[model samples]
Every structure is written in C-alpha cells, then in structure tokens.
Target: MGIFQPLNTPIRDWQGQRVWIVGASSGIGAALARALAARGAWVALSARRREALEEVASACKGETRVEPMDATRPEDFERVRERLLAAWGRLDLVVFNAGTYQPLRAAELTPAVVRGILDTNLLGVMDGVAACVPLFTRQGRGAMALVGSVAGYGGLPKATVYGPGKAALINFAETLYLDLAPVGVSVFLVSPGFVATPLTAQNDFAMPALMSPDAAAEAMLAGFARGDFEIHFPRRFTLVLKLLRFLPRRFYFALIHRLTGL
Candidate 1:
C-alpha cells in the first residue's frame, strides 16, 4: 500500500454483490439497501422489525432477503448468518448499523439506560463481528463496515452514554482492521454527522451539517468506491470534527461548549 493510498480493496462494482445489513428497517440502513440493490447488489436486510424490513425490501430493485434479528443476541445473529450463507453461498459484505441514542446529561444518567446504550451500540456490533470473523477467515475474502458516529471523535454534552458507546466502535474498528486486513478481509469504519433519522429526532438542539438518510447512503457508496478505511460524511461537518481532535483538551472542551452551547 502506498503512503497516501486507500487502506482496503476498492468496491467499485456492485453487480451481483451480496451484502448483509443488520439494521435495515429505516433510516440510512433502508436507504443503503435500496441504493445497493439498485446498483445490482443482493441485499439481506436484518432488524427486529419484520414489517419494516419487508417494506424496505419491497422498494429494493435487485435480490433482497429479509432476515430479522436482534443485534444484541449472539444466537440471533448466528442463526441469521446461517440462513444467509445457506441462501447466498457467500456474503461479500456485512454492515453492523444497529444503534440507538438517548439524550442524557450527567444528572440524567441511570444504570439501566447506560446499559442500554452499551448493549445496543457497542455489544451488538461486537457480537456481529465475532460471529463473522471465523466465516470471513474461511471464505478468504469478505468485507465489513461498522457504522460509527462523529460524536465518537470527541465528547459532546448530551451524548453522555451514547458518545462513549460510539467511541468504543471507532477503536474496535481500528483494531479489527489491523487483524482482518492481512487475512483478505476489508474493514470500513463509517462515521456520519447528524443525519435526519428517527435516531437523531430526539435531539432538542440544532444539529450541524445535518443531511438526509438517502444522502448518507450515497456517501457510503462513494466511500466504498474509493476504498476508504474511515468513511465519514458530510465532509464539511465531519472534517471539522476530525481537526478538533488535534486541539489541546482545554481548547477542545471550550470549543465544544461554544459550538453546542452545553
């Protein structure tokens, strides 16, 4: 790999590709399923909501299979993976995108809610990765994309528990890339700014550089085409967060306070 080159193999062609998305009921996941299917990829949609997954599949253009499963359950993911492999023979890519966000400050923190954040946002994805690693290693070629958040890049006020969960994903993805890349596996870390989805609808404060789910899906497609290790978008918003990480802690905290007014 060159110094300035992409870290993974470029996935420019989607024709006949097989993709499994763990959170495909609505928001960016649904939009991504539609986008990839339109581009001739066979998409498998997974989520707890079967009705919503069916709705998403109804709109997809190419082959789509609805595989509903709770991400936090290792057995659920294991069962679904077996079904998918039996049907498709091999999965080209799997995206762990199931997550939730709750607006909580220091005072509002509760053990149950904190556990909820940790379970869904962090543990769920980890289980999916654990379930797939052996399969991918055996296949000799596979890819995975973990959906992270810009909130993970640094701390924010309301994200209290949510922020920590996503921060863990960024680190997990980085480490997974190091281990998996040598074994013919491609790992992509997808970070997005506030996209107008049900997940972000709970926010009371004005969000910066907010884009739609469709737009977010398009950005992922572009990133996959370019073979980027970290697929973050809207660049205008995410790039600023990327730069903010370089600042000293005092300045960084002050800047966050000023930007968020929290």
Candidate 2:
C-alpha cells in the first residue's frame, strides 16, 4: 500500500460545493478558480484587487462571487468571513493561495523584504486559518488547501526570504493535518514546482520543469480528488527534490552548490 493510500477519496462530484479561494486575482489561485468553476463548484474569489477578482469571476461558468481583500490584514479576513457565512452558510473548501515572492540573496537582504515575505506568506496563512478553523470545526468537516512551494523543501539560490517562509508553511500544514484530520477536516499542503505565473516571471535563471498555470491547477485538482495531504506536481521535477530533501546536510549543501552553482 502507498504511504497514505494511493487514492484517499475521489472528489468526483463538485456540484453545489462552496469553495473560497483567497488570492484568486491571478496566477495559480485564478487558475484554480477557473478549474473548479468548470466542474460546477461555486467559487468565492478574494484578493486585494477587486477588478482582477471580478475579471476572474466573470469568466467562470458556475456561480462566482467576488470578495476582494488584502490577505495580510486580519480585519480583511473577518469581513470576507462574514460575507461567506451570509452567502453560503458554510464553506466546503478554503484555499490559501494569496502570496508574494521576490528573489533576494544574502547580499541584498533587507528587514523590509524579510518582514514583507513573512507577513504575506506565513502570517497571512495563519490569519486565514484563524478565521476558518472555527467555522470548519463547527461544521464538523471542511478542507484547507495551502499553496506552499517545492522551494520550501530546502534552501535554494536567490530565495533567501521566500524559502524559509515556505518551509514554515510546509511544517504548519503538516501540524494542521495532525490536529484536524481526526475531526474529519482535511488539510492539504500544495507544493508546486516551477510554474509559469506572474510571480515567477521575474526570475532571471532558467526554471526547470516549467509548467503553465492551468497545468498546475489541474494537478492540484487531481490531488484534491484523491484527498492527498501533500499535493505536489510535475513528478519528474518534484521527485528529485523529494529525494534531495532526505540527503544528509553536508551532502545536501554540496549537491545544491553543484547543481545551482550558487
């Protein structure tokens, strides 16, 4: 048998499920909303940009609601929560995909950059959890899918602040799963390899195993269908990273230097 069963529970039906996707203004979040809506899921889109959210919502086939707000602000989540509660009465799935990324090295590190990454990537996810946990616990069942990164698996060149923040998220999702799984709530840590999105477009180096946003979104839904806890994609790329994660520290550092020349 596989570690957590090859297929946990196939989500073959998506009719009438209310899914709230934060950061749906663009990138993977936008792609996910499009994919879910195609499958008949009613999606509530949230992001700081109302126009972007509305654009995505308008393109969807199923019923879509635009709830724009900043992920970094706690009060914004509170407002969105009220709207979701009033509209759907309950949320079946919450996807925390609101995040920002900037390539930084030790040479150019700044307190502002560090704090900015932590605030949006780490603290923002926590805020989403704080808002959703009570609702999920009250309902006795719900699911959370957080957008982490393969970059989180280990230290990478040009990812000074982004890497550590995502590492925290990976651990956070695992801890959430341990605590929430027993109560029927599922937690997923979605780690994507190099995907072509607005976020990664700023990268200077060649991105290996690069996939489109739509492809990444498809893999996520496929993983969700199987009720996977860690949903990573483009196995050709992610499998090697998974193996590298198990390497000894000395070997890991040496291999990273050899591969990335950083």
lDDT of 2 by residue, 28-98 (tens): 99999999999999999999999998899888987899998999999999899899889988899999999
Residue 56 in candidate 2 has what lDDT? 93
lDDT of 1 by residue, 1-262 (tens): 7898889998999999999999999999999999999999999999999999999999999799999899889999899999999999998999999998899999999999999888989999999999999999999998999999999988899999999899999999999999999998999999999999998999999998899999999999999999999999999999999999999999999999998889
**Candidate 2 lDDT:** 0.90
What would the TM-score be for candidate 1 when compared with the true structure? 0.98
Give model 2's TM-score versus the native structure: 0.96
Superposed Cα RMSD, model 2 = 1.7
Compute each candidate's TM-score over C-alphas.
0.98, 0.96
Instruction: Give me the runs in candidate 2 sitting further than 4 Å from their true place.
Output: 1-10
Per-residue error for 77 in candidate 2, Å, reads 1.0
Model 1 spans with C-alpha error above 4 angstroms: none
